[model samples]
Target: MRRMRTWCERFLRKRSSRAWFLTESNRIACVKRMGLEAAGAMSRSPSAKRHTSSVSLKILVDMDGVLCDFEAYLLEQFRSKFPDEPFIPVSERNTFYAHEQYGSIKVELKRNITDIMSSPGFFASLRPISNAVTCMHWMRDIPDVSVWICTSPINKYRNCVSEKYQWVEKHLGFEWTKRVIMCKDKTLIKGDYLIDDRPMIHGEEQFKPNFGKHVVFTQPYNCNVTTEWRLSLWPERKDKLLDFIMFLREGLAFRD
Candidate 1:
């Protein structure tokens, strides 16, 4: 009995060490011992399953630049608020961020721009990009396509967060307000395609392990970026958008 207990204790210690190591092979073995299928263990993982023919094509659309004329509105508000302060025209914008462009002229100008953006009703008052609303409605009506507004609220979330919901409600309708996903790290969100104006969604320091194909929404700021899935004009270039969606669907179907 003493020898058997010693053998059991040694076996348990070895098992504990393997568990502590947590290697991929050890994890699988441990899971199997626990009576769980190794494959089934990660059934709920984001990248576990690819979209089959029956599965809807999930497309994540950005709010500010893609849906609404964020830069135009910001310029208008900045000019109205600070008439004398120098401003960069929308056409002349090169950098991804508006404040970065203003920083070159005057350091204090960054704060001015920030104040305008973070102010209440700023997002709500912004006008929709030409044909953006119409296109959104059209996309929503497409069969087997799931559209979602994936946006990030400014750091000054006090007014920015609530106003974003209001803006969506006002423009995209009340139902779309529910589709709004205010996330800081968009990489975590799972979608087949992400239509965004920004060149890099998750910034430089972080690794963006997103499963979606980034469809760069053409803007003066991100004009330098060259992507096959670039969306320039809404409704007019909507054919290209449809083509991309169909291509992805066919590819996924073939893969499945």
Candidate 2:
């Protein structure tokens, strides 16, 4: 270290070296050119690249819109209970929380919603979205990609969490039961990708994404969020997801 400092002091006498050293980036490059030993010492510092070949890319999937059609299931139950209620197609809805559309009978609707969410079988009975099962099965066997079903349960409803586990084990099988993470704040969880329906989870200004690409799943409520990766159907969405994972893997395998 003393030798390097002396060498730097000698170079300070040169006008070109003095100007070059003023810029931190240029000084670092000059040190590399001087000798590999100094460069190796710098590389070992805190700024060193710690990433390794053994590190795997993580793919975190949402349970509701991405896989299980929770919105569809809830709507179906709503329609069944109120046969005489004026029909409003799901497309006409602008947001997922559009309970105001239920009109004067919204009180009953709210009660039903709470009851269903708190019920034991509500989450378990949800049918898997088309192509979701096949896509998940394929993802589980993919190399270098760690897959997890990251879901948020209605924390107020105590049964919501256990029901989600029951649903995962029954549909995705027991193997996936181990990968379920129930948390409302997705930002705290780090990953390479987050495939979900809502983009600005709570609010962009308040709850910003901590990292990675967010592929918004197509839902009538989230139709207003315009983006390049909005996938409407299952089959097409599955292909896109796999292609994105491959793209990430290729990038990781390559070096300058």
Candidate 3:
């Protein structure tokens, strides 16, 4: 029975890979979520030892929009600093540029960075977005699912990652087993999936060829939207963040 089960799994994996032109691996989420108990029981039930390989889903999640709401925090900071400044929607950028209305724009400055560092409450008040916890839970439930947080480290801002990690610990209530990397090139580091907002950094195919799918968390400033896979952070948005993640899980598979 043990050998037969192994053979069956190998056969199924091969079939799935060939069907989708994907590489063969035991990263199937369903297998991990559903079959672990049975696999364990068969091995210890005085029956033949089951040779079932535990499937682990590997995910590389982006820190800012996917895991936390950094953009909204920035926006709030901007508004607080310059309440009188006229609101210029991110979509209106082209018009603002053409009209040379750059003066009305509120940019996050060095002082704002300092403010973020100095104020504990400012950082503490930053709550994760609506589906952030759910996303984390999904990754946790998977036996083999490991989430490596990838974020672009602001070159001048060395302490950015430190604050972010502290926030993550406060929110997650535990240290992450998978390490977090503060890197300029997220795609260069290996992972099955990348959840990020910046297309210019992680969007390039060179950095993410092996990724099953790249997930972009939506924002007003990130106005240039792409249809391949994206989710808006807005409460009333059409695609919930979870919806996009589920789509990736069901539709995509990593390949060599």
Candidate 4:
């Protein structure tokens, strides 16, 4: 463990100087390799194994709006593709689905919206929301918290599915790609908290009960949702979010 720590420190120092020269994949590979090596060394130590066993909190974060600027990117793509078409601005959007907002408008407009969404590279090209990546890393580093990306792909899965994985790998690193859960029915998944922008998450005929608390990740559309826990700003309100998670963790322990 000592040797591994020493090597990691030295490696970090070396990488810090030339980080700009390294490609995204290469940088991710280097960091992942070091993490695995350190984890392997720690696993051999009795104290580390005990510490690992204590981790219990599971945080399931939604990808599209929570992590990436999905709506913003979609709007941009829609505008660029169909220049003259009437479209609802992001601020004016009142529904979770963008296409729903265009229902009263031209049928061609709605089809154009869907086309933009189903297009190849649309999901992969979305920019990460400001401070979202940083906040995710912070959450993952929390001793007891286990952060996982729980996202639903569009019904047009051909492009949406592969691009979602690529997006995670490109932005959050390859290690996080393994943590991606591409399931339509999120209520079936178990976790301590689920941060999502959708006002209603339903499965099949009715809305199923989620095992975890649904912490609304605020967006223009979901502003109407009345939830006790909501994350409107990243990093800025992250401390309060942590407090909420910890409070729940303690409450669960007390119940036990």
Q: Summarize candidate 1's per-residue lDDT along 1-256 as a digit string, tens digits.
A: 3433343244335432212122344333333433233223223221222222344788899988999899999999999999998989999998888998898899999999999999988988889998888778877866778999999889888988888898888887899988988888888888887889988777432365363777788899888876555667564445434534544553321010
lDDT of each: 0.70, 0.63, 0.51, 0.71
Candidate 1 residues lying further than 4 Å off, grouped into runs, are 1-55, 203-208, 236-241, 251-256
C-alpha RMSD between model 1 and the true structure: 15.7
Which runs in model 2 stand beyond 4 Å of their true positions?
A: 1-55, 98-108, 203-208, 236-241, 248-256
Preferred candidate (lDDT higher): 1 or 3: 1
Point out the higher-scoring one by TM-score: 2 or 3.
2
TM-scores of all candidate predictions against the true structure: 0.73, 0.67, 0.58, 0.73
Q: Model 3, residue 178: displacement in angstroms? A: 5.0
lDDT at 117, model 3: 38
**Model 4 vs truth, CA RMSD:** 13.0
Tell me the number of clashing residue pairs for each predicted model.
0, 0, 1, 0
For model 3, residues 211-236, the per-residue Cα lDDT tens digits are 45565656554556554455454222
Q: Give the alpha carbon lDDT tens digit for every residue of 29-144 in model 4.
A: 33354446434533344234323535488889999999999889998998898888887888888988888777668876777888888998899999999888988887787687
Residue 206, candidate 2: Cα error in Å is: 5.6
- Residue pairs that clash (backbone atoms under 3 angstroms), model 3: 56-144
